[model samples]
Each structure stands twice: as C-alpha cells, then as structure tokens.
Target: MAYLLSSERPAVAAASRNPLLAILRWAAKLRAERHQRLAFREMLEFDEARLEDLGLTRNDVLEAMGASAPQAGLHLQRRRALRSAIWLGRSSF
Candidate 1:
C-alpha cells in the first residue's frame, strides 16, 4: 500500500498541474488569435464558460486582447507598469 501510494504521488501532482498548463496554453492561443486580428465572432468561439472555470472573466480576456493590440499603446504601457509591480511584489522576499 505504501509503495503504491508513493508511486501515485507523481501522477497526482502531474494531474493537478495539467489544468494550470491548459489554462496557460489557452491564454496563449487566445492572445495569439487576438494579435492576428481575428474577428470577434471567431474569438467568441472559444468557450467563455470554460475560461471562466479557469478563473478568467470575459473582461479579463478583453483586457488581455486590448493590451495586445499594436494600436493600444497606452494599454500596453499600463500593462508593463502593472507587470513590473507584480514582479516587484514577488521579489520582496
């Protein structure tokens, strides 16, 4: 029983990591699609409810897409500022 439990631990950890990796991949795909100037209708094909289950709101997706737009220079600046703050906070050890 102990040996079996130990062997299952890595599988359990990998399983837990899968959802996070999936969300990251989905986000990357969504960002790439937005950057490619995909139509809103095409973007909407991505299941919003599934993204929501991953803790991302529609607004979050919109914001990410907006920030990624080349013409949205101001939004990109704000995102850089926010990202710097986040990294700063994480580094405050």
Candidate 2:
C-alpha cells in the first residue's frame, strides 16, 4: 500500500529495522570525511599563486582547514564549485 518512488525509500525502511546499521553508516561517513579532510589539509602547501590558479585563496583553504571534517569538505567543495561556475565559466553548474 506504501508506494515510494524515491531511491532511498528502501534504505530508510531497512534502517528502521536495524538501528546499528545506521551507526555503522555514520561511522563510515565519518571515516570518509576524515580522509577528505586530510587531502584538503595538504592543499595548504600550495603557494598563493598555485592556489589562485585553482580558483582558491589562502584564506579559503585556511577557513576550510579550521572547520570539522565534514564541514571543511563541504565548504571547500562549495567554494570550488562556485569559483568554477563564476570564474572558470563553467555554465553547466
């Protein structure tokens, strides 16, 4: 009787049946964020010119580096995407 068109409907239903499954998913997500954060931290080694070439500034990297892993990744990604859309002329964004 419950017709669902969303792709995640099954996942949501399964998650309700097994609470620990949700915890494991959360842990996996955190681990992924940690890895992404480390990669972003490495960007700090780039000089201002190099960062600028990538459409990022030292302050942007510094700001992302200061946040939590997930937030930092989202912040950097969002900034880069915006830069690409505006500066790089990626109209598809």
Candidate 3:
C-alpha cells in the first residue's frame, strides 16, 4: 500500500473531505437565492399601474432584482411617499 501525504491542499479539497458540510452550505445558499428570486417574481406580478402607485417603474424593479441591495425597499418606500404627497398636492389645487 502506498499513501501520498501533503501538508497543504486547496480549501475545496478540505470541503470535499466533509461532504455533509458542503451539502448543507450548498442548500443554504440555494434557499437564499430561491427567496431572492421569488421576491423578484412577485414584483413582476405587479402591473404598470400598480407599480406607478408604488412609485416604482418596471426598470426600478428590474434593477432592484438584479442587484442585491438591502436599501432597495427603503428607497422604494420613500418614492411611494413622495408620489403620494405630490398627488395630494395636485388634488388640493
């Protein structure tokens, strides 16, 4: 019997040594990505009028979905409030 011992190996090799850990990591990543994709899909369900009401355009939603930014929701909420204020002002005229 012959054995090759190496003191240094790639991190991937270490991960391969523990298949369970690698599988768990992969599953966690997949779940996170799935949730993100679902969020985008739900955004896509909104019609143009609904998006306008939310003070968001299709492009805004698309950009938000493409970029993983936690502030996107906050930005959209601000826009919605601004639009609501503008609409109220116009109604008062």
lDDT of each: 0.56, 0.78, 0.72
Candidate 3: residue 17 lDDT (0-100): 64
**Candidate 1, position 63, lDDT:** 69
Q: Candidates' TM-scores?
A: 0.27, 0.55, 0.48
What is the per-residue lDDT of model 1 for residues 32-79, given as tens digits with 9 covering 90 to 100? 766555643344566876544444445544665665455444543454
lDDT of 2 by residue, 6-52 (tens): 66466555654577987889899988877877777778788888997
What ranking emerges by TM-score with the best candidate at the front? Answer: 2, 3, 1
Query: For this target, which candidate reaches the highest lDDT against the unseen true structure?
Result: 2
Q: Tell me which residue pairs clash in candidate 1.
A: none
Per-residue error for 46 in candidate 2, Å, reads 1.7
User: In model 2, which residue pairs have backbone atoms overlapping below 3 Å?
Assistant: none
Q: What is the lDDT of residue 36 in candidate 2?
A: 72
Rank candidates by lDDT, best first. 2, 3, 1
Q: What residue runs in model 2 are displaced by over 4 Å at the alpha carbon? A: 1-15, 66-74, 81-93
Total backbone collisions for each predicted model: 0, 0, 0
